[model samples]
Target chain A: EAAVTQSPRNKVTVTGGNVTLSCRQTNSHNYMYWYRQDTGHGLRLIHYSYGAGNLQIGDVPDGYKATRTTQEDFFLLLELASPSQTSLYFCASSDAGLANTGQLYFGEGSKLTVL
Target chain B: GDQVEQSPSALSLHEGTGSALRCNFTTTMRAVQWFRKNSRGSLINLFYLASGTKENGRLKSAFDSKERYSTLHIRDAQLEDSGTYFCAAATGGYKVVFGSGTRLLVSP
Candidate 1:
């Protein structure tokens, strides 16, 4: 089984505040993703990386910046955070990319509250 | 934009009863995954299908890329089955779009 860990299980920040959510996967998967879950919306992709130093914009990338420093580490940065960005964040990793790669192993979500 | 339309925004089933959840794709998807948001607020992967059907325990899932749809069937529901279920479809060559989710409540 793939193991994905996330830091700061819970966070609270104010508008314009800066917040960073970190994710680390020991699975050495080549694909990593950042997602946010909101009510009425299951999980929306924010950013993803196919490999180290590769970042791709997702369906909902506004107010979010992500970095894949290494194959095992991915970070989601919320610069100038806003109330609309408050949501449960999840990180995932997959050993494959493109087709047949949706079999993602996810980390426990991080709850972020923006005031 | 790729969109996934999931039906039955909410479902109610009694223990030992069964029901099905469906997701319809606006565009052809390469694959689909089903997950359950557990009580502890963690997503548990249930099934990942590129095509055809797969069955595990009391759950079964099928994905048809050409038909642009997928279905998840839960039989003999248990209390542990009560949770939010989501379907995510891989579209284009890059991203995956998720459904609005279905909240399932299983009672005695």
Candidate 2:
């Protein structure tokens, strides 16, 4: 089975704080994505990477940045966290090819609370 | 932007009952994926369909790229099947658009 692990399962930070969420996938997939889940909006993509050192913007990329340092590791950074940024974040990986087109392996998720 | 609209936003079914969730895409989708978000905030992938239908256990899903729609059917619903279900559509450009999600509650 594919394994995607995330760090800091839960976090509480004040406004203007810097927060970094990390994710690692053992499946060796070529695509990695960062998404946030809100009440009415559901899950909105924040950023995605096709491979190491590749970044693509998603629907909701404001106030957020992501880095894919390696094929297996991806990071989501909140430089200046705000109350609106409080939400459950998920990291996922996929092969993104014909062999595994829409099959995504997702991490447990990281919940961040900004006060 | 690609849009995937899913409904009904919330559903309640008794144990042993069944229902179906639907997603309508604004543009043509190359593929569709179904996922259930457990209470622990873990997303469990249920099915991925490029076209036609696929089934596993009491769950079945179908994607019709020509019609720009998809459906997920749950038969003999159980308590453990209750969760927030989401459908995502991939429409080229390596972009996958997600629906607002349907909250399913199965009560005994």
Candidate 3:
């Protein structure tokens, strides 16, 4: 089974503070993604990585930066945390590209609160 | 622009009842996926269809690429099935666009 894990399940930070959320996947998937979920909105992709050092921008990449240091680890960085950035963050992984057989396995999610 | 639109922003169903959820796509999609988010915020993958219909357990899902829509039918709904269900579509690339989601409440 594909396993994805996230660190700092719950985080609280003051405005302008720097925050980092970490994710690790044991499936050795080639693709990793970061998304944020709001109350009435669907999950919005913030950033994605194709491999250990390749990153791609997603729909909502502003105020967020991502780094894939290893095949198993992906990180989301918020340089200046704002209240608008407060949301439930999820990390997902897929075996390869987006194909019919490629299903995304998500982490439990990290709840970040910016005060 | 929203690439995916889901119907019945919210739904309430009694236990053992059946209901269906729909998702309309803005453009042709290569594949569609269905997911159920539990109360604990875990997203469980229900189905991933490139085309045609797929049945598993009491759930059935269909994806029509030409019509740009998909449907998920729940049979004999159970209380444990209460959660937010989302439909996502993968268009021409590796990125998948997700619908706003439908909040389902299965009451006894």
Candidate 4:
């Protein structure tokens, strides 16, 4: 099974605070994604990376930014956090390229609270 | 606009009963995936299908890209089967969209 580990399983911050969430996948998958799960919205993609130094915008990328520093590392940053940005974030990795696609393996999730 | 619409938002079944969850897509999708959120809050991949059907144990899933839909059938529901199920569809570019999810409760 593929392993994707996330740091700071839980976090709390005040408005305008800076927050960074970290994710590392050991499987060397070429694709990594960040998604947020809210009550009525379900899971919406925030950002994705095809490889190191490559980032793609997702549907809900308003208050967040992401970077892929290495093939195994992906990070999400919130520069001026607001209460509405508080959500459950998940990191997933896959080796999807063309016809050869794989299932997404997700991290345990990080719950953030902005007051 | 939401690309994937999954129903019934909630489900209840007896231990030996069965049911099916369906997802309707507004446009053609390249592939579909089903996942169950386990008690530990991990999203467990149940099935991934570009087309046709795949069965594992008492659970089976089918995807019809041309028809713009997918179905997940669960037979002989067990207590452990109770969880929130989500269906996601991808239309290439590695962008996957998820449905609202169905919460299933199996009781004895």
Q: Model 3 clash pairs?
A: none
lDDT of each: 0.92, 0.91, 0.92, 0.90
Clash totals, every prediction: 0, 0, 0, 0
Q: Using Cα atoms with residue i matched to residue i, what is each candidate's TM-score against the true structure?
A: 0.95, 0.96, 0.96, 0.94
Q: Which portions of model 2 show Cα errors greater than 4 Å?
A: A97-102
Candidate 1 per-residue C-alpha lDDT over B1-108 given as tens digits, one digit per residue, 9 for 90 to 100: 788999889999999999999999989998899999989889999999888999999999999999999999999999999999999888746577889999999999
Q: Model 3 compared with the native: what TM-score?
A: 0.96
What is the docking quality class of candidate 2?
medium
Q: Which residue runs of candidate 4 sit more than 4 Å off their true CA positions?
A: A97-100
**Residue-wise C-alpha lDDT for candidate 2, range B1-108, written one tens digit per residue:** 678899999999999999999999999888888999998989999998889999999999999999999999999999999999999888775677889999999999
Which residue pairs in candidate 1 collide? none
DockQ of each: 0.65, 0.53, 0.64, 0.53
- Give me the displacement of residue B34 in model 3, in angstroms: 0.7
What would the per-residue lDDT of candidate 2 be over residues A1-115, giving only the tens digit for each residue? 7899999899999999999999999988999999999876668889999999999998899999999999999999999999999999999988873234748789999999999
Instruction: Tell me which residue pairs clash in candidate 4.
Output: none
Model 4, span B3-104: residue lDDT tens: 889999999999999999999999888888899987767788899898999999999999998999999999999999998899988877677889999999
Proportion of native contacts kept per candidate: 0.59, 0.41, 0.51, 0.39
Cα lDDT, model 2, residue A53:
98
True contact recovery of candidate 2: 0.41
